[model samples]
Target: MAYPDNLLSRGESVVLSKRPHWKMLVLPIIFFIVIVGGGFTLAAVLRNWEYHTIAWIVIGVLGLLLLIWLVVVPFLRWRTEHFVITNYHVFFRSGILHRREHQIPLGHIQNMETSVSFWGRLLGFGTLIVESAADQPLEFENVASLPKVQSVLNQLIMDDKQAHRGGPQQGGYPTGPTPAQG
Candidate 1:
């Protein structure tokens, strides 16, 4: 889904937006299949029992609880999580009930690094480490299209730096004459 436009500043525009990689849901989906299949198999086995109706109810409740706690919660969290890069800032927000958000202005970014294993490269997903002017670096894990994301952020940071300086500055001085010189 598109990042909500209202979150951006007046002139800011989104460059990239993504949720965590689909790999993050693999375990949860496996759990769902196992729990659901096991639940159905157990219910079928108990069909001939004298207390079959109560047994079915008990199985259903347990299955539902397992589904909600394991499968449903992770899916909700995945859907709610957002990593957005704009021309001006990088925004990360995630949570279902209680939200956590972090915004780093593009100009504040000092360095960036990406880590990808063989499987991650094959899957087109990896972790991005963003070191801003802040003391500690922030790691964004399971980022989809990690290389593209990193490249876009690099470009945006460069552009932001140039814009703040009123175009690219060379050496240790401004590009043009100073006010006194002018």
Candidate 2:
């Protein structure tokens, strides 16, 4: 989707919006299974019929809540949280009930780093740390396609710097080799 023209100076364009991969839900899915299994076992083990019924009802409810919290919640969060890279800035947006957005202009970004653990590397995902001149650093965690996102950010930073040096005009920002290309 086109970003508001006013948000960009003249030539800025959005590179991509990185979302948490579906694979990130693995842990939550496991948790849901464990909770549901445990709940069913507890309900089945009760000796008294009345107690068994009550236990089953309570456990069923608890299991449902756990499923909602573990399986559904993270999925919703992954759906909601967006890590957007534009030619001018990086935007982190996340919310379920109350929305929150954090934007860091390329000019204000002092440094950027990406970290991938063994599992993350195997899964092709990682966390991105964006340090800005502002006090709080922005973290884009569990983002899929890490290399592409990092390269886009690097290009944006370089392009912004070059624009400042070259004098601004209305046109798409220059594209260059991503880190992977190097």
* Candidate with the greatest TM-score versus the true structure: 1
TM-score for predicted model 2 compared with the true structure: 0.74
Best by lDDT: 1
Compose the digit string of candidate 1's lDDT tens values, residues 85-108. Answer: 998999999988999999999988
Q: Weakest 10 consecutive residues, lDDT, candidate 1?
A: 165-174
Which residue segments of model 1 deviate by more than 4 Å?
169-182
TM-score of 1: 0.90
Clash tally, candidates in order: 0, 0
- Residue pairs with clashing backbones, model 1: none
Off by over 4 Å in 2: 1-13, 38-51, 167-182
Whole-model Cα lDDT per candidate? 0.91, 0.80
Provide the TM-score for each candidate, comma-separated: 0.90, 0.74
Q: What is the per-residue lDDT of model 2 for residues 1-182, given as tens digits with 9 covering 90 to 100? A: 33344655677677887778668778888997899788877876774676677778888888899889888888888778877888777888888999898888899999888889898899899999989998577777888989988888788888788778764333454456668897
